[model samples]
Target: MYKTSTKIHLYTVRSQMRPALLLSMTLFSLLMLSSCKKGSPGSVNDPGTEPQPVADAAFLQVSTSELNTMAIDNKNVLWFAGDNRGAVSGLGNKNKNVSFVRVADQVKSVSVSDSRSMIIKSDNSVWTSGDNGFGELGIGNAVSNGNFVKVADEAEQIEAGWENGFIIKPDHSLWASGFNHYQIFNSSYSLADVVDTYQKIADNVQAISVGQAHVLMLKTDGSLWVCGQNVNGQLGTGNNTEQRGFVKIMDGVKAIEACSYHSLIIKTDNSLWATGHNEYGELGIGNNTDQNRFVKVMDNVSALAGGRFFSMAIKNDGTLWASGYNNQTFGITGPDQNKFIKVADNVTAVAASEYHSMMIKSDKTLWATGSNTYGEIGAGSERSLSVFTKVKLK
Candidate 1:
């Protein structure tokens, strides 16, 4: 629980003190009051002193990670509900109110798709849980693991897709193992490859983002590479051709993210770009037309997240924005927002799942809005929240 008090307690002394001492005390009190920032309770400026600001009852410092179906907190705790299962057994076994459970301690990073979940441990080793029907676990078998199982070592990052898993090595090379039904593995080679273990895919890969059946990779030279199902022009290669291997799409890219059928990117100029299926206007280009090539959407984007048919972004000034399919029954607001619209201010991080969204503000507090049929809102109830609400992690 959080307190809503803004009153400051002051003390008065009966005996007169020296002019110098009284003046110093007054200055200290003023400093303490001025240092209080929103979301952070208690002043550290004058610790162990009288009339100190009350410490926050809920003191959890948080950063949120939404895996398109699951969410994690700064403490490596996992929150899940709805159709997705496995990965951290019993985390949401009941299927009612959202269950509060931590996956593992010291988790360096995590990733998930519609059915699979992956995590990189503190040892620089990779572990995976959930559906593995296509050898998505990269553990030399097609069997699934309800509990996390180690698959690789010295991994810097991990990403999961509908039927594939990807990892980045300490040397910056890329490795992948799983179902390549859409030629997401070897673009120029045959699609008959069935990887049972980690197989070298590419080199000089800096980052990766995978969606339903497609993927986007950022090369060390700031060039963007893409592959997989392009039925909706998700590859953004000017045609609806499914790539055999990664094809260079653009240059001067900084970050990229994808959802079920669309992709978003942030370029070096701090501008936002989008391409692919736009049935729900997920591209945020002021229309619902599918884009075969990248189109400029907004400017000054610092970070972003893409969901099933919607997108969320954080501007350089800490304002949160959302676009794409929205209606009175679900989504951010309006029947739909073809253009970006402000949602909140002072947001430091933002994440989007299939049908919901979450964000952390500068105050280190967590807030959520959108779909909550399975209690994904972290409010410990099944009631769907159409407006932002404080997630009670405590």
Candidate 2:
């Protein structure tokens, strides 16, 4: 009887071992399955699943009524802007208007630097042209020379206001000319005066941005100075009175932008402040009331752009935010409310025109929103959209 009982105990132990072995095998299978499902990072079994190649850095291609601008910062890529009436790409030397020369033929956009002189920075060195009506071209009123003529000494930076122009000298001084309806061009209180004012404050100007009727400057002291049309309180002076000269509006400004009727400034803290027309809630103040003083809109802002009647911004995390007039006429979606709304994710930089908006992602992909009446959005379609749509530029 003792032998039989021992045998029974051994049988029971064997039974338990079988189940344990099976359980171990099951766990191993699951681990293998998980590994197969996830695969290796950045590897794809199907070629179709691979991500499309994009440029290494962010850039933009913009077009105005009479000109186009292709702004690129990536060292490995070349930027090109085609003319509204021309087409040339990859055909060697055909009769196409797609070459870099198109940028020189028409004076679409111009940028100057105090150290570089006046560089059209477009396609060729052909950097100055257009109305020159106000000598805004800085080429001394040579009207018959309808084409862009190079200026001898380049400027540190150039700013084009509604009807005026300003240049920053190497000495950190400011020089300006053209229309100054509200003393914006008063020789006594012009660019030279601005440089003097900045000197008195122990601040050096680094950059300048001009709005339709206002001027904004960034001082080395991290403060923002504003002047010009204040009829709609776009000056952010805490009042609606027009400022004949530059006045300190806020401090710690890291970047600034100006629109046709509004202004925006981003502080070092990644916060945004906007003043001016709120007719479409462009100020993002939660209401349509005009803001004469700077008001906080959101945080973590990395980049921003303004349009004639709307605005857009990007956060550090690559999320895109837009507000104001999002109508078909403007190339975007709804203005839902007086607040910023996320439109897309993974955006790197944003650019805005009077009626369209464009963005470049870290992967070098481009996306657009708003109006496309003139192929400004580059979709070849003339529909207005609220959400972002990818742009195929190959």
Best by lDDT: 1
Error of 2 at 86 (Å): 16
lDDT of 2 by residue, 155-195 (tens): 45555444555656555666655544455554454443322
What lDDT, from 0 to 1, does candidate 2 have?
0.58
Over the stretch 115-158, how does candidate 1's per-residue lDDT look in tens digits? Answer: 66777777888877776667777877656536677888788878
TM-scores for every candidate against the unseen true structure: 0.77, 0.67
Query: What local distance difference test score does each model get?
Result: 0.71, 0.58
Candidate 2 regions exceeding 4 Å error are 1-69, 73-126, 144-147, 152-156, 169-171, 186-203, 328-332, 381-387
lDDT of 1 at 47: 37
- How many residue pairs of model 1 clash at the backbone? 2
Best by TM-score: 1
lDDT of 1 at 260: 72
